[model samples]
Target: MEDAVGYRLRRAQLAVFQQFNEAFAAKDLRPTDFAVLLLLSCNQGLKQSEVAEALGIQRANFVAIVDGLEEKGLVERRKSEKDRRVQALYTTRAGSDYLKELMPIWAEHEERLIARLGGTRERDQLIHLLKRLCD
Candidate 1:
């Protein structure tokens, strides 16, 4: 009675992300925000275009993400020293601290994902196959 593939997959995806959303709610951060912060922490002073490219997000859509991060006081965009017209993005001190606090929870979430899907290899293959379907 409950075997529709679309329903199952959508529910599974929502369940996984809902766990993440709950874990980071205290910091008022979304998964994408956590990703952006982590990326900036590792690749300090990256350009917005580079972030957009890495995330596979279009420039227009990325504006909303940037605005959210800025409003949360998690990141700042500044004029690039070499190219005044280009803006470089950097995570703020609060962002770094928030990431530090959430790192363990993120790790646990990854473990839960693997457990839910059997194992990492199985999950990876599932994702690869799903991606091909989209293609």
Candidate 2:
């Protein structure tokens, strides 16, 4: 069981998430929150459905996530110019500034993980392999 790929992956994920939660505890951000915020910051005015689909998150769950961000004043939903019925997601100025602050913390988190994986080369290789699995 210790040598099994699935077991190893689960263990690694748990450890990574623990570190992530600890690092962002003060900010009250989670992995999913970071992912959603990062995506919105990069590509503004994306529809809720589009963002949910892109993130592989279910519609129902995605709504809650967006709501939380909205409450945090980091995200906003605006009526899409192209479609009056559809709402698009966007990051506020505060959200963008928040991301800038988070970048260093995120980098440190990745650095710690990379160090554990042995280095940049190993990290890249692992990322490649992980992408292959995901695809």
Candidate No. with top lDDT? 2
Candidate 2 accuracy as lDDT: 0.94
Model 1 spans with C-alpha error above 4 angstroms? 1-11, 127-135
Best-matching candidate per TM-score? 2
User: For candidate 2, lDDT tens digit of each residue in 1-135?
Assistant: 999988999999999999999988888889999999999988999999999999999999999999999999999999999999999999999989999999889999999999999999999999999899888
Q: Residues 24-95, candidate 1, lDDT per residue (tens digit)?
A: 777677888788888999998889999989987899988899999889888999999889999999989987
**Each candidate's lDDT (Cα)?**
0.87, 0.94
Candidate 2 regions exceeding 4 Å error are none
TM-score of each: 0.79, 0.95
Tell me which residue pairs clash in candidate 1.
none
